[model samples]
Every structure is written in structure tokens, then in C-alpha cells.
Target chain A: EAGVAQSPRYKIIEKRQSVAFWCNPISGHATLYWYQQILGQGPKLLIQFQNNGVVDDSQLPKDRFSAERLKGVDSTLKIQPAKLEDSAVYLCASSYGPDRGTDTQYFGPGTRLTVL
Target chain B: AQRVTQPEKLLSVFKGAPVELKCNYSYSGSPELFWYVQYSRQRLQLLLRHISRESIKGFTADLNKGETSFHLKKPFAQEEDSAMYYCALSRSNYQLIWGAGTKLIIKP
Candidate 1:
């Protein structure tokens, strides 16, 4: 079976620029999540979506970062006016559903972003 | 708030030696724990979960709720065992709260 897929495996941008990352989740999965992993740190969730509806986004920087799961299958995370501190790996993952909360989450090869 | 910790930044052991990666968590409720691994050039993937209580690739982790720890252990480490390991905790059965991962290097 195909795993989660992400575009532009690596990205480079300047501070204050805008950057976007895309994600295509596993087929039939109903839960999608976006996480940011800084160097030497674990992945921290930025947002979560269940069938196009946001489930959580408490950690997201609302002033600059935004994410959307359009049509409930693909997702895009965007950071406007990016900062040097925003340099990190953007990981996308999918799960069967919220009811299967602890079910394994399939992850995509993350997009490594560097802000100069 | 839920938090996970992996105290070691790096761990090195000779091939065929025993390996143990430490993990600790802080949560008020019954927590579900998981170990995720990332091999070079590979995406992070689930290695095991505490609820399953199963071993994979000869690595096993036992959750000690009393100590608030879930340490990954392998009796005989192999070169292939070298990778980045993360310990995560899910509070209230929701999305995971992850630890800063440990880099494992098994030298031959």
C-alpha cells in the first residue's frame, strides 16, 4: 500500500518570505496531521484534521502559520513571513480515524525547510 | 499538560551488545505510549506501542506506569539497529506528545 506522500522534500526560503508544503495522505485514512520537527527535537503537531474539519491546532502559530485539508484527502501547510526559527522538518501523517486514536500513524518523508 | 522526555541525545554501543534507550513521561491520566523510529533517509515510523505490549525487530519496551517510564531495550543490538528513536505519549487517547529523539549508533 502507498504511504503518505509529501511534495518538495526540501525547501529554502528567506526570512519574511512565504512558504507552502503539500501532503497527500494514505488512501481511505480519515485523520490527517501536520507536525514541525526542529533539529534535535521531536515532532510537534501544528494542526490535525478529521475529514476536512480541524480537530486541533493549539500549538500552531496563528499569526503566521495556517493549514487546510481540502476535500478531506490532501492538505497544505503554509507559513507567511517565515522566520529563521521556523526552519524545521514538516511531517504529514494519517490515521484511520479518531475512534482509532492510538492506531498507527503512517508518516510521509518530511519536507525539510530552511529559512535564511 | 502532557510531556515526554528522552534524556540521551546519543547512544553508541558495539554490535551484539545490549542497548537500552530511556523514556519518561508526565501525564495525569492513563497515557498511551509509543516508540517511533527513523532510519537514515526514511520517514519516521511506528516501532511499537505500549498498549500492544509486543516486540518488533527484537526490540521490546515495557511501560512502567509507576515510574512514568517506557524504556526501549534490545538484548543484542545489530548494525541495522542504528537509528533515531523517539518516545511519545498520548494523553486522553489523542494525538501524541513526543520526546526529543535519541540517536542510536551501533558500531561493528
Candidate 2:
């Protein structure tokens, strides 16, 4: 089966600029998530969506980061006025359902973003 | 707060040697543990989970609540075993708290 797909596997932008990453979850998957993984660190969730409705986004920086899962199949995460510290790999994952952690999460290749 | 710790940043083992990747977590309720592996040029994938109690690729991890650890172990390592392994704990059965990750290198 096809796994989660992401676009522009790598990106580079200047500070205070805007950058956006796109993600398309696995077919028939119902839960989607976006995570930021800094170098030498594990992934930190930025947002989660269940069938086009937001499930959680507490870790998201509302001032500059935003994400949307329109039509419940695709998602986009955007960061405006980016900062140097925002340079990290952005991963997208999806699960068959919101099984509260039991379901296996399939991840994408991730987009490596560098802010100068 | 909930957190996961991988004491070792990097672990090197010879082929056919034993391998162990330590993982510890802090949580209040009954936590679900998972080990995820990311090979070079590959996406992150589930290696195993505590609930499943099944070994994958000859690797097994046993969750010890008293010790608050779920260490991944394999009696015999292979060259293809080289990868980044992450330990994660389910928080409130909804979110996951992940460890920094351990880079495993199996020398031929």
C-alpha cells in the first residue's frame, strides 16, 4: 500500500519569510498529524486532525504556525515570519483511525526546512 | 510532566553481537510504549509495541513498569540493523511523548 506523501522534500527560506509544507495521508486513513523534528531530537507534534476536524494543536505556535486538513485527505502546515530555530524536519503521519495510540502511524519522508 | 528518555545518543555493536537500546519514560497512568525505527532514506516505522508483545526482526522490548523502562534488545545484530530508534510513551492515551532517539550502528 502507498504510504503518506509529502511535497518538496527539502526547503530553504530566509528569516521573517513564509514557508509552507504539504502532506497527503494514506488512503482511507482517518487521523492525520504534523510533527516538527529538530536535529538530534525526536518529533514534536504541531497539530492533529481527525477527518477535517482538529483534534489537538496545543503545541502549535499560534502566533506564526498554522495547519489545515481540508477535505479530510490532505494537509498543509505553514510558518510565517520564520525564525532560525524553525529549521527542522517536518513530518506528516496518518493512522487508520483515532485509536488513542493503539493504531500504527505511517509517516512520510518529511520535508527538511532551513531558515537562514 | 510526561517525558521519554534515551540515555544513549549512539550505540555501536558488531555483527552477531548482542544489542540493547535503553528507553525510560515518566507518566502517571498506564502508559503504552512503542519503538519506532528510521533507516537511512526511509520513513519512520513502528518496530514494535508493548501491547503487541511480538518481536519484529529478531528484536524484542519488554516494558518494566517498576523500572519505567522499555529497552529494545536483540541477541544477534545484523548490518541492516543500523538505524535510529525512538522510544515513545502514550500520554493520556492520545498524545505521544518521544525520546531523543538512539543511533544504532552495527559494524560488519
Candidate 3:
């Protein structure tokens, strides 16, 4: 129904600054994902959470990027000391369960971050 | 590692013409494939998945395991079909791998 929800549809920060994004998954969704989509490129998975426990974070930049899905419903992605290269659209998606891997992933409008 | 590829960056066709959006994937295991679409100013949404063997919005894709391809096609294209399409592949435990995506423009 309501689909995933994201806050601050757009954000701008200077290089070396910090930024954070918020996302709320659909009700009853047990799996949530964060992805980065640069212009002209496909969305790349950053992290995945299965009810507050991380299922995957292989691509996340531990040095400066981190994400947490506390309480298993809402998630927040933070980037400390943002780099110009970090400028991209941050997308959040959620699914009912892991068993439904082929099921549709409801996506939010995404947070467009611009690092100057 | 699994990979998805959308060879064409852009495809243009006139209204009422046949349309095809090619998608090729490489994976070690029996892969699951999906097609996602994003219209202007809209969030990306799933178009269809190969496992279901179904069609949506007049678009259908047939999985060819031998060819390692899952090309989306429609008998006739409409102007409203214009959008960005991405092909994705998922393995056993990993997340979906996506292609660069193709922008389909249906000319009026």
C-alpha cells in the first residue's frame, strides 16, 4: 500500500561534511535494503537488514558509511566526511520476507544527495 | 558473482511498433531474473519477474536458460511505454545485481 517512505527528498552537503538519510519500510515488511544509484547507473546495494539484524553489508564503506535498522522497521544511513563521489540518489526498498526473493520490492522516491 | 547486462543504453520506436528490450545475465546457479521500470518523476517499480512467467503492461519476457537471456518484448509499443528499464539477477543468498539500464522512448 503506502510503499516505502524516505525523508528529505533532497540533501546537499560539502565535502568532508556529514549527512544522514531516513527511511521507513512498508508495514509488515521484514526485509529492508539500501541502495545507491548514481546518475546514468543502476542501483547498487549498500546494505540489507532482516528485522534489525544485518543480513549483508559487504558493499558498505565501513570507513565512512554506516547504516542501521533499529527496531526492524525504520532505517538510517549515515555518511561521515562525505566525498564528492558520494553524490547520488539513495534508495530504500522493502519486501515481505526473504522467501519471496522474487517478490516485488516496494521503493521510496529516494533521497537525492549532492556533495559539493 | 552474478551480473546483468542491458546492451542498449537507449531504444527508440514509433507508436504501434513492436518493441524489444534485451537483457542478458550471467550466474553460476539457477538464477532469478526481474525487470524494473522507472517513469519520469516516479519511483522505480517492478515490471515483471521471470519466475512468474507473466506479462504486465503488454510487456512479456521469456527466460532462455540456454541463451542466458531474458528479453522483454511487446507486440505493439505505446507512447506511455517510455521509461527507464533495468534488468536484475539474484542468486541464492545475495542481493539482486542490476544492469546499467535502458531508456526506452516511444515516439508519438
DockQ of each: 0.85, 0.81, 0.74
Query: What DockQ does predicted model 1 obtain?
Result: 0.85
Q: Tell me, by DockQ, which candidate is best.
A: 1
Cand. 3 TM to true fold: 0.97
For model 1, how does the per-residue alpha-carbon lDDT over A1-116 read when each residue is reduced to its tens digit? 99999998999999999999999999989999999999989999999898899989999999999999989999999999899999999999998976755467899999999999
- Expressed as tens digits, the lDDT of each residue in B1-108 for candidate 1 is 678999999999999999999999999988889999999999999999989999999999999989999999999999999999999987553688999999999999
Q: Which residue pairs in candidate 1 collide? A: none
**Residues A1-116, model 3: lDDT tens digits:** 68899998999889999999999999999889999999999999999898999999999999999999899999999999899999999999998766655346889999999999
Q: Single out the weakest 10-residue window by summed lDDT for candidate 3 chain A.
A: A96-105
Q: Per-residue lDDT for B1-100 in model 3, tens only?
A: 5789999999999999999999999998898899999999999999999888998999999999999999999999999999999999976664789999
Provide TM-scores for the models. 0.97, 0.97, 0.97
What is the descending lDDT order?
Answer: 1, 2, 3
Q: Could you tell me the TM-score of chain A in candidate 3?
A: 0.96
